[model samples]
Target chain A: MTETHWAYAERMDAAGLRDLMLAYGQDVWNLAFILTRSRDLADDVSQDVFLKAYRTIGTFRGGSSIRTWLLAIARNTSLNAKRTAFMRRTILMGRVADSRSSPSAEQEALARRVSDEIWMQVLAIPYKLRETLILQAKYEMSIREIAELLGISEGTVKSRLARARRRMMDAREEVEQDA
Target chain B: MPDREPEWYRRLRGNPLQEPGFTEEQMDRIERLAGERSGASRRRTESRNVRRSSGMEREGGERSEMGRSRNETNGPAANETESATGDRVGESHGYGESRRGKWSGGMEPVAGSGDKVRTGAGDGRTGRRPRRIRLRAAAAIALASVLLALGVWRFGSGGADPAAPGPSATQTVPGGGTATTPVQTPTPQSRLGEPIAVLQLKGMLAEQLPFSAEDVTGFEIYAARSTQALTVPKERTYVLLQNLYNLDLKAAGMTGVGPDHYLGSSESATLRIQTKTKSYTLDYDLATNTYGAFGGTVFRFYADDQVWLLMQGLLNAGSIWAEYDRLSEQSRIEAETRSNADEPVSKAYSPERLQVAGSDYNGWEKQFLPLSSGIRINDSYMGTSSLIQQLGNDEPEVLRVGNAIVFATDANKTSDGVGVGLTRDEVIRKLGEPNVKTNTRWDYRIGDYLKFHLLFEDDKVRFMTLTMPF
Candidate 1:
């Protein structure tokens, strides 16, 4: 109903969708980039988020700001994509190593792969533990803030954090021993 | 691990958790998405509140109809939502695979929500079964993979000029947030101004004969019957005619209206009755008596607590309807007399004549008819008035069948008006217009007559007929 500007509605269009994809696309790709460790997978996830958001925007009912609603969609889409990728890989290529086949010399790809391997170990932990570790490791989000975001008891946050760290440490030891 | 936390855990507490996978572009998409969703939610909430506050007026007899009109306007907005979902699915169709991820694990629940009206109605048709929804889901997965590879091409490429809006008003959302473009007007009629003319059907109600929804032919038969009955007695005619209109609605099972006397069953039922009237509006309540009066005076039998009060409760809609017929007959007579008195024709064209035109053109009124050969040519057209009985007047130029009149010329083409004398042949060759006739009985444009009737034989002027002047 903004007579002067329908900027938000326009953004829902293809060009607007593209303008948006281009403008803040890197954040989405980076999120996808980190989760999949494959640039292509990251790009795919970024586009999916927009596609879903564009489709469902009509039902948004605008209770909160559009930015907030979109972020929620982003979070949901990312988590779902990550889980599906995990299942498909597990199903098709039984517990494949996170290590790249080529192990190319480029530092960035290496950095991404090594981080992804660590994250894969992180994902192996239980939901409670994984949740705490992701907030701490990936987001650098403080425990208090993470507690607020997840709407959990801070005590639960504290306990989960303790368990996640132990898991990470155990995972590091196993890798080291194997090496 | 330590008591509260291991030292490494403590270090982690302050550490900025690396956001595992979101790239800058991903964040932007999320931001814009949130903006749009919020905007839609706000609009819906505002309208809901508006409807709530308007409830009292919405139910009011007159206001309820207006509310229905407004609801019809909201249909386009629903279509907009459908298309948006369609485009989204089409985009997903390109993603093919590699969509598996942690969050994807539970999405079976979210996708279960029935949002797939897109594929069913996205192409502008509606109604797809749940099967279609599942089918779309499969297509989306494949399409998603395709779009992913194309995504690099899409995002890696530079942004050029924005895509121009589609050729439709809703190249985006169905009706809202769209712009209009001009279309060319191709004809002189288009330039003539407001070519879209309507005879104001609602207002035309009281102004027409048998002003009801009954087809013209059936009603004409009824009107002829009623006109025959009109001479019976004024009071009885009133009782019969009104019953006709009332029975028409009653048979249709319509009720509920502005009041007890004012009623309609549903909007559709109301429209059926209303189509006969000049206008369809919330103001219909005032029209019950007002519209009928304009057509002519009423001959309705008096309604009193004695007869009306008793039957008013019993389906004495019969009485009201009978009264409509009586009043309608009275209205018809008054209009005929007034019409006949004005120019010259004695009455509205007989229902038998009207039966021929096939069009519902009701108001072809009487005017000063220029008669010759008794031929009525394009009575609806301008500048000529004449009527022909049988193409060639053979029988004694008098119509002896009913209350009819005949006037003919005495001289054969006198020089009085037509510059020279002539036989029927010469008359047709020169003054082919109705005013010139063969017999002297044809007066030149009867100074103050209503029309001239020309009687012809073998397509040649045989005699002249004229409407006697007062």
Candidate 2:
């Protein structure tokens, strides 16, 4: 087997770690953004993920790809960041505001771009389903890989995908009908 | 069996969601943190060596002096020294324990360790000699107690414990502290609001059709399993319908092919057209590209290669159309259940059963390999290069340079198939082991020479070559 990036995880120097960051920085940040739904939080989570990865590189057992491993870190970090009381209150407030039909300025801006609108739809799903969909679609992770990453069963992954797709189609139908 | 991704999914994959890039300052901060950590560890190692070499030479004198100083000053300066030393020792011990696989309870342990270390160092330097030694032992006991307490509190509170169960790593948040309250950290609300669905047409198909894609009301396709109402945009529905309208059987040179020529027993779907006054249904065989509409009599016309491809593209763009057979089985069961429930069986449908004809493998062979989006053996090197570039940045594994180029599959990017990204087992299961199998190359001999081969790296099919004999 070809040596994966994890081969150097245990003893990676600064330059080696920098290379890893450059390779997966965008991916890690993107996943963080998807989970947190906040760019600033994503930035923090990305930094923490890389630092955590570097600090604890020795603990990695090479069971999964380095990308998968880093993504898992990003996921956990984002979730933890969200669980902070400050984030919880902000999210609660945001949800309250969202309950109103008035779209936020950011939402209007996002709707202006078809691609951004697609991303918004993806983010609008419940966290679990949204995460599973992004992992499958954006990351092209196999059902098995997603299941492993999310600590869910393969059947759950498939079902979530079905539900997410159905929701997306329904949303698209609504938009088309409105148009 | 994995089905091909739908058109929307492919679009999403092609257009990656935007992610905010790391600022230069952020990069520098992380690098600095890494440097500090390495530096700290190196200092820790040196300190340990120094202590080992010196043994207890100055231990007694330092202890007496520490006690006198502690008695003389128990002020902010002492507190400062205590907290600073606590922080350093805590960080060092956290790193050391993480290496031993004992780091847990998130970053709390580091903080807790700092607290204990501070207490121990405080007592050792300030307390009477006997008390100092006793306090050291108590500090050790307290360290374990704090770790246990933190673990219990973490699980009990269900709070922001960064060390959630996942792939192993240091769970501690950098700059260890309890979850900050909202007042201290004013985080902004998530910008992404409620999900808004947007319609996106399949690329290239809308552009290819020579029709004003307006005035089309609705479009639906009848697949083997169930019918799907395609959500074609208002401006694009005509693009699809115009293709059907343009297939005029009465046009010049339009020849009627025999039922045997057009009709086949392969899978097919029907397109239903609805107008204000009338409705028409056209049946098209997927394998043969033969389509017919029954009016007074069956008008079977063979669609040209271009028209057939456009039709395929339309069908492929729809969700659930690609996995026709699988969904057919599922719907068959559902249909049986609905029949029992006295639901309308009219909605239940299957591919129109037609007379079996000669094999269509030749027609399939004339097309590109189904693995990739569009790649065929004997395609010009430049053409393949352009296609690969369009596919993505995945560099194909080139072996024995020729007209053919093998594209490597990226698990993170490419959809799973018997294509470049397929694992060894997947390729073997799809197309059995080759005639000649080496470490990195699998060659299948057709007749005499190797007609089909796959080059592997890291146990995944990197390059695939399939050449048809003349």
Candidate 3:
């Protein structure tokens, strides 16, 4: 939300940059984490996004909020990272690797009981729908804001939101039927 | 009782799913990378300034013979900066610390090669210049590839494949330009009747000018829609034409009747080439050639490269054209990445949007449709005023009523849901309260680049307009 910080970021010192990292680092990380659904992927992406933002600070024209611009950059970077070897390997071998990575009884118990099935279903949704839902339902972004951030028309944003809501409702219906 | 919120939606808004914060070690590495990038950006800026100053000093020399300036050819400043920055960065990033390090070993040679260029260019010998140029070109290509790769990944496309004219015999303008005119030797096209034609021509010229503007010596394109001017050096102009057709003016069916006049023809159109000639009378004698005063021939081509010989001349147009080219590419990539779902964000105004009758904002946006027909924007650099002029069908003077943009063009398109002449209270009654409101103004978002701003006078709608896309 501190959108004006980038106005002077071009000449900002290490201290200023550190302050910025502290201020907005969590939000950026969370955005990346939501998109990737992996903390480690979020970590790499958040760093890359900040480095890119620091480098391209001069290109920010002050026409939009700095947060919007940074989020846009994060979206691009995260998508690009998706094509890299690490991400591909992670996604392809993830279920097995995730089980292998945490074989303890406590981890299994936590996954079964603590984790919310609906939230997991939300993450399980396709990226485009999931992102649209997250931005609107979580961040409370307006239709216009989502369209602007995603670089799509407002009509498209509305359609995507409708589709995402329908999918969530269907998932809920299946869960209730099973119950 | 109030309806319970969706469990998933509430959880998304709550703090239960907070991801872990970055560790100290990750922050340190991130800081170091940011520092290196920032330092590189600073060095690039400094190098550009050095090149500009050095190039400007050697104004009368034939530096462009190499198709580049002396500073670019020498390239000491950039090389020096790169090497110095690389050393600092290498030390900070712990490059070469481990064989299987995250930092690539290829960075070392790139930095070392910078030093090589600085030393080689300082020697100033012709023999090794060829090899040096080749090496520099290779390095430049490598750097360009890296940047291009970044662009492709960022935008998920090959990136804006700008349809630039090949660097060949013909000298097509960089930005788009006029169509090859109809075959009439001296009959100029009627300007007033061909407003749309002229507008389209201007759009093309703006697009093509980016590529060929380097040929122009003077540029003044934004004065009036009817008149524009361009100039190029006499010798360069001749080279451009001669090389384009690969023929001499005399051999190409042209007769030089006067010192500055040549008449030529093709199968269809007659080409009249005229130049502004000047002579200096000698006051004193030189060793064996001339007198006290010396004159260099500067060619001035007037309007009418086509049939009637009308239209403004282009000045040192290449520079401006190049800027537009760069900015356009940036916009294209940004838009592509933003709208990556196969369907490009439609710039077209939907007819359905206009059908909303009884809305207060109706006529304002419908005003843009008729204006949008013939008014094509080649570059985003143009302002709202340029588009408004074409839509209103009024002269610039008549349209210059107030600071506010006039959205009252005569079109049958239905209103955008809101109309003019509504009071602040009435507008609120119809459209609900604006997202953002001030004492005298109200703002509402129609889309990303589209917004409505209303300025009120005495609680009445004094002016209202939609924001234009860049």
Candidate 4:
């Protein structure tokens, strides 16, 4: 979308905002879930992303598509939530296991779908690679867009995507061999 | 040639991954939260406005108070009151706007009484006013004497009185007297040209020094993994010092006088701030959000958020200039390599060329020929029409944007067995709710990548585009 199109977010009224939430809510929630790997955290982060957007919409400046902008906010909010003392403690206590063993209903459904095992593997990879892979493969973000959103160099994004795919492929091979 | 992603990756675009169900209830909650935030923001703005208007009233009162004191005291007391008012006004201007507002708010009642006293003095009846004025003058003199004594006591004790009126204190004079007791503003000690340890460490950090290249003899960085420190160039040292100088460091406390004072086993990095006479080492522990300085004694200090990040970035990089140069070079090479490759389409819709070993699609390609060739919902009208035309179909209504190709009437059924003329319930039984839905239109994912848009009329599928994957 053109930069001018994003200005709609700045002037968006309640109805416009509702339409926005309807259109991109899933994308925002999905990105948040991928980054945090916790449904509860994703819900909180998604709410926070919209709240922040509402408060700072005047500063949007039409720099990116509203979806990309919301996703970027979701990414930052998720990372920040993960960095909190509470989340860190949870992570340290090993309560936040891989997606297959995660207790969330969505995760359970994910684990049951043999075709969806690729997602479980995506989640198993390191955070940086997993995030880069999801943004590229799932969200269809360009390398340049991912780099800007993550505040990293394009070279780093490319390298992480490559590494993430290789790791997923290896994990798939292992699963097949076991079967 | 660049590496191709495996075919199984296409599952990501398929609706295999289930997002948590977002309901109207959740949207209502979001709206409610936003409303509460808006209300709070409005209240804050109104509070500021009220404070501002009250501040203006106080300023008017202060002026009247000054005039009354000048008329009533007409002596050293008057001069002292004028000086005190002047100092308060100076403080209001010197400090920030919020503090200025605070000063005005605090002085309002005192200034209001002064206005009343001035009005009393302005009365035409001069007989009783003389005695009242004399009584007020005597009280002002007595109050001034007490203040002078207190100042002397404080000075002799070599410490500030804990109960002394500070900048934020609201002082009220007894009776109707507008004269203010003299207040002695404390002078902060200078730490110029002193040894880092001997000087007031906290004050020195807070002070802005007139730094020159000659002041810093050496600047060294000790990386977390490195045992020895690397001496930074003078130019870079200046930049680093500038950042350090700008830091607002709050004195946390004095560390214990042993190796145990060091909080962590490893530091993020250490900086040696070298001057001509002495070298002060600052050890930063990012994990603990604390830094220790060793300048004859260990002192812990905390930097504000921005300064802390600045310090972390500089130390983490070990060499900021080198890191920047390396990243720039790497970016340039990556940009060149990317330019050589074909522009990547959305990976969701892009045809997968590389198959993963031992993975099989059971005649998936034959079942969905048009979709396999990338024709899907939301594809450009021109592109979809051209593709359909190329397939040798001369359906006249195909060029119309909203015209639906009825699968029940047409030659093809989707791999998922979904066809046009299917009831809304039947379609839902097959595909579930659309990812995006409106009253008239519903969009469902064909796989992970392609979408199947169904146009509805009278609660039934009138037109549908794209075939779902098996």
Candidate 5:
């Protein structure tokens, strides 16, 4: 196996980046699919993500692995894209709600339980916490890799995930109590 | 809570994550991207492979087996990996991907924060925005509980833990298993004599010198045997002394101290602290063709390679000029070869004299041992060391001889310690000197600095060296 960026995240020309992305395309796409739950979102975000990585790789100081850097970019871009879409929909809905005076009960219920609610919640946490959690759940990365990828103390990562778990537990307990 | 941490860690021992969707295509893609990002660096890997394959073709293509042989030559023995200095030991398996399967306690570090992120509830999206993010945070916590339960269940079922880190993460340096090291202990001969004493005396000199040498210290003379094959007759020793003393009087850097009645000249050259110093003297005795040649008494008042590096360190590092370059570590054998190059002199003859030994491959080969110690080294850059041994020891004193020059070392183990690089001129001037001297090169060993009569033709100080580490 060959490692390219031991020194730092050096910049790549477009064609070269294309080859690298193609090599890691499935991994990146799969990651995007899980994050966005949309094939179109995964594609658009992936292409955009690689270009962004290409543009800024020069600034990468190499404190972390290249995969971590790329994944971090993909994660952030997808989240922002999701946010922008939600905003656009919000604007559209406000207009529709104002025109109709009130949304129907079924429509309100459907709006509350969007098709990707579970995924949306999973993506909602802070980056540090979410990354560790996802690697454990999806990529099945060990604590060592998670620590290496993010440049965090392994102890810190563990506690952060532990906190995340506790937070989820409390959240569930509250919801159940309410129910 | 801290103690409880270990229990959570214990779970990692039982439940290992299945391999992710890493495939050959993925690895290839990564390799290509690495290439595009690093043109030559990536190219070097493939080229090296190609070079290896092509190298095999030249030898009838028994390449795979030959490759291992060549690779072994690069990192000769497993023992070579024990470097005295511990800096370069790092990860193994130079793969390009970042995310990997869980190693320690089955927790993969999150890849660095990327472009994907969640938005605040009030960031313009209408219905998708929950009134409070606290709800989303709660959902995340819920996900964690479920995963934990799953991990625990897996653990209970005797599945391998995804978190336990490999030995690489947990091992210590002594057993870290790197492939090349220079952690050799010197022999008792090194501990017994002037080298050890000089090492101790170096501390005192270090207090005097203003600077220090980088990396090299604790030099031990591996051997100090005498050789007798090259000894000139006693009468010739007197004649040689006369010629050398005359040469010193005419040397450009010399300044006479007393009247010409003493019939000798003194050479003086300024020295940079921790750098090479340039000066000494010579005297002639008319009765015999004997000239007592004495000059170039270098004294580095510093510790270690400060003086030596000062003299020879700037000779184009990474250039072919270097005695040793720091690039190959893939194997053990190559490191051994490189180590030999770094040393100026290696062998010490068992007896003081020999008629013949070693081949005359590059430079002069001499029978060495007994009265004079010799070192044969390739005088030019990129050249191999041939021989350097004393030819004779009529007096049985261990002296250094090389090229066509010869000199004796005068080190002292005082209360301050074993002092190396003390001036012979100062010693002779105070002691009223030798009844005879050799007309050999005006040589000096001042600390780590070693200078010989490099300019027999230039009656001036053309052979001055100022790079001793003191």
Candidate 6:
């Protein structure tokens, strides 16, 4: 009998891998964007992570959900992308802000609000704390699930979230004072 | 810090940082890339197999060297590592439990002992047996290949042409192209359309008129079911009968060869009918004046009196038609009763007038009230839209605003049902002039909050909205 993808990992054809990748495309793409703080880099990281997962799917065990496993891969891929000088230079020049011209006036306004200096402060926060907050606020991932995905302890996830929230609150206060 | 999140955080919770999803184009590109990758991987596996086979041949000369190599390659440590890797891979894909039974034990020694290898060196004994076994396997595979070719040659290719079209996918749409989809097979529920009623019923007679010819020269009188004869203009009768026959052809799921020629089949028999080109079958009832297929035995208009003898072999006694006629009459009676009981309430006749319209919407029945009379109950949005049932067929139903009554009147009704498509001027003329007229809306006030609003777009009544307190 022909072996299924489940029974034979290294023997899995590209179609099987592609079907698996399609399910988590959105989650991985959004996670990459939140981490990289750049849509262009997020696109690059998402493609790279899927290709990499296709190569290393055999190494994956059932210790975590496929989504969690893919997210773990996405986290590492985003971190590696962020460290590149090209991405660093883009961030330094404040060119990472989304500027895609939206046709709808309401959507454009909302995008502008999301890209405001307040969100920039959140981005300025350390990577670990920033990802923790984004996962909580944006994805609504629980502390335990975030810990399992990030390969960190639950206590570490909770502390990171608290620190991220404090920094964002303090940054908002400072902006108000300046205004 | 407050326990609650900030407004920014709250907004972020509800709406994630929106990212553009993978487009269809990207998905297609990904699939193409995957196919290429898999093809490359298969090529690599094929090359590996070739290399391994060649290596085995070269090592066949030295027995001891081959044994040592095999031990190194297929050792217990290597087997354990493979097992762990397989387990991990299987676990990821949800097949871990089934595979746990597999590879649970340690690998067997490739050569039982060094003593066995020494014994093999004395003679070329172990080598000759493997070569003979491989030869037998090769012969079996070759024989199977020959048999397969013979089978295909005799049965597969000769029996049927792979490319020959067996059946037409659909009917030929007259004068050229084939139909993209098949014609709908007739059913009892299918609306009676020209020629064939789909079902044999007396009610079908009411739909059309038929005529008879006095000169039965070419037409032989089959078992004549109807004795009374009616005359119609020969030219008109010919065209009408021809069209009715075409309808019958379609209803029978057959294509007509020519006028009065049809080829169709029932479960038990195939029917080929050729009646006189000018003549057609008429129903027994003269009032309905309908044309139908004539059959003293089968469902066809027979041109000869042989049908009388065939009628004796008939299995059924027209009970199906009788049951249908009885049900049709029963439904007609029920519809008449409903029409009388649920007659549209006149505005002058309504005892319940709006008291304080909006404010007095207490103790309102959440059921269908007599006020919603004349308005067709739109069951699609039943109790979904704010617990108030929406009325009308396709367009939104118009009821008197702040009151339950529907204004289904000549003044209110327009070409697009009640209160729709009427001009502001036309509506005013019909409803005896509006009590209030805004720039965009004309309101006919019945009470404090109850009113009929004629919403206008470009001075034409676009639609109407009733303001009921509910």
Model 2 segments more than 4 A misplaced: A1-5, A85-103, A109-115, B1-4, B14-20, B23-25, B38-470
TM-scores of the models, in the order given: 0.24, 0.34, 0.33, 0.34, 0.23, 0.29
Candidate 5 lDDT score at position B314: 21
lDDT by residue (tens digit), candidate 6, B355-413: 22232122222323433332111111000011122334443243221123333222344
**How does model 6 do on interface RMSD, in angstroms?**
31.4
> For model 5, what is the C-alpha lDDT against the true structure?
0.27
Docking class of 3: incorrect
- Summarize candidate 2's per-residue lDDT along B1-470 as a digit string, tens digits: 23866656665563334434555566665666555553444543343243235341121111111112122222211111111111111111110111111111111101111122111111222212111101001100011112233223422433332221122212211112111111111111111011111122211112322222221234334443322222222222322343343332322112333222221124465554333222234555555455543332344444433233334444453311222212212222222122112311111111111000211212223233333332111111001111111123233232111222223343222122445667789876765565444455554543222344455657875555442221
| Residue-wise C-alpha lDDT for candidate 1, range B137-204, written one tens digit per residue | 11000111122222123223232221222232212111011212212211111111111122322211
The most accurate candidate by lDDT is 4
True-structure Cα RMSD, model 3: 24.3
Two-way DockQ contest, 5 vs 6, winner: 6
By lDDT rank, best first, the candidates go 4, 2, 3, 6, 1, 5
Please list the C-alpha lDDT of all candidates, in the order they appear. Answer: 0.29, 0.39, 0.35, 0.41, 0.27, 0.35
Q: What is the lDDT, from 0 to 100, of the residue A110 in candidate 6?
A: 39
Give the lowest summed-lDDT range of ten residues in model 5 chain B: B93-102
Stretches off by above 4 angstroms in model 6 are: A1-22, A86-119, A177-179, B1-5, B13-21, B38-470
lDDT by residue for model 4 (A49-123), tens:
665666667768767778888887777556544432121122111122232222345446557642366768776
DockQ winner: 2
After best superposition, candidate 3 residue A41: deviation in angstroms?
A: 2.0
Task: Please identify which of the two predictions, 4 or 5, would achieve the higher lDDT against the true structure.
Answer: 4
lDDT of 2: 0.39
Per-residue accuracy of model 3 over B259-346 as CA lDDT, tens digit each: 2211111112112122111110111110110111112122111111110111111222232222222222222223212211222122
Instruction: Quote the positional error of residue A138 for candidate 5 in Å.
Output: 3.2
